[model samples]
Target: MIQNIVLGQIKRDPRSVAMANAYGTIADGYFAVGYNPAMLAYQQDKPFMLQLFGIDMGIGGNFISLQNLNSLSGDTIYAAGENPKNPHDDSKDRLFRQFDDAGGLAFRQDFHLPMPIINYSSGNMAFTSNLVWMSNLVFPIGILELLFYGNGRRPNMDMTFNVEVFGVNELGFTFAVPYDRFALGATVKYLQGLFYFGVDPDSSRANLVTSDYHLYGSGKYLFRFG
Candidate 1:
């Protein structure tokens, strides 16, 4: 439904909107994978590179990248804007907490999901983030369930439980090259994220001090390619 609504808006001017969306898709590095996964396939003999970028749109954007760290490792660090709350308070602990908390996991209490794997490969895996359980399954099937409708707490769990993520979570491969432009190489890609913080608790759109208190999610999806 969200995609349908978004697509509908773009359909009004498919040409320009499509191009804009295409540019963004490319900017995200998906084009690199689509254009030539082969080029990214080679790694062992390429010079490692690190890229750092930033942006300012009344707010701000900052990012860093490490490419081809040896034959099997890489990393990236990124942060867009300083949270309005306690923006000037540069304490190490809060910064560290913000860096690790992600995927809204820090907003609510008493949320749990058994990380179950549904698919696996040397460099890729697919998993279910959500699950459904009924009390009858654990209790009784024939008991006179008088207290049936709304008899128990309907807990609202994290989105990961209901949302399905089919992604290239990890990728790696080896390629053969010749002398000069020929060599052998390999690569590895890994993915992880955490998001916290609830939606704006009140009309106050930005995080601030003394007015209210809330948790926010901070997460980044790192990409690695040689």
Candidate 2:
């Protein structure tokens, strides 16, 4: 579904995810040139960096990230997406904002866990893997409530739609070799499983109709770099 596409985009892209510090993995930066940790160690000359983030639609602003980078064996490193929310704003109702029949919005004031990615070298060969997670899901209560009450207040029509399951997770792997003054690599991605969802159409709840989500695919390519 398109919802999945949007979710995947926000997850894979640094510009969109806010807390994503790793480059190359997205489009820019060199970290993504290969999936191997050994390749990253090559660039350890750069000191660790931390990013402070915040977001708010209009009234108030909320902080969301505290990340750090350091060196490790084979040039592998890890980053945690964590921060704390104030004492006041701590409820699901307050954690998220509902825009009409749209989905719920939550401010990930604190990251669930540290997203880890690693790269390593063995002789002329290198390898890398990325395991990251973020929360951008907006679950609208209005939609779920409608599932129970046919017409919570106004009801006249109904709607329903369905599509095939394509994938649930995205996995990327890279294989590379070191050459004179440079490293080269190629990646293969495997998108496994599929999930589908559709809502019924109803005029009163046109906002909660099946035609709401914007669907797209979650696929990418990997290339070599030094």
Candidate 3:
């Protein structure tokens, strides 16, 4: 089963979740902080933009299911399908069979913490301070099988697991310059390296104990451009 911790929960912003930040109505106010800073240059003459604490989550995949769990929890579980008996014939069917119905997991999360210390607009000139963060995780079908059903029903061949997880935080200011029917915008940013962890282990015929996670590196810096 998939488990996670959920921060402050509240009514979600319909607009932010309804569509991607790239395409949507400006009337909705403050566009995506990462994409098209220039779009904010055309705000509807609002006095202030307040983007306090908010969280967004996206989960998708087709690996873990009632069938998979049932098989794993049975008194005397057996491989779903009999292992290819005898010398397998070499063909497209033989090679692709490994991933037929293995299973998978994917997820994305956004944690907002009173970002944009300051964000206000008037006329053509727009000024703002923005802070944003995001995290992504995915697990292929082969990895799931080795982790969940490797003991009960051992399969043929070996597999490697290289799962990755990291987060990025950007602190910066955005300004826009308008010209007749056109306008330009730029953002100066200070990037902070929060953390990064990795694990590289060959299943070695479905050994449960893998490898230890090692500390890598983390830092911060400043950069800006259009």
lDDT of 2 by residue, 81-176 (tens): 221434333232322232222332223211211124333323333333323222233333444344434343323222222111122344544445
Q: Pick the candidate with the highest TM-score.
A: 3
Writing each residue's lDDT as its tens digit, candidate 1 over 1-226 gives 1121122111112332467445322211112222222332233344332212211111111111233223224522222333355455444334333323432212111222223342111111111121211110111111111122121221211112111222222222223233566333222333333422222222212121121243333222232222
Task: Give TM-scores for every candidate, taking all chains together and pairing residue i with residue i.
Answer: 0.16, 0.28, 0.49
For candidate 3, give the lDDT: 0.43
Candidate 2 vs candidate 3: which has greater TM-score? Answer: 3
Rank ordering of all candidates by lDDT, starting from the highest: 3, 2, 1
What residue runs in model 1 are displaced by over 4 Å at the alpha carbon? 1-48, 54-182, 193-226
Q: Which has the better TM-score: candidate 1, or candidate 2?
A: 2
Worst 10-residue lDDT window for candidate 1 reads 134-143
lDDT of 3 by residue, 1-226 (tens): 1122321111135664465332422422333233444555576564465664444454433444567557546443224343365233333233234344432354544554434335444443334342334444544445555554553443432333234455545455566665788767665666666665544333212223332343222223222211
lDDT of each: 0.24, 0.31, 0.43
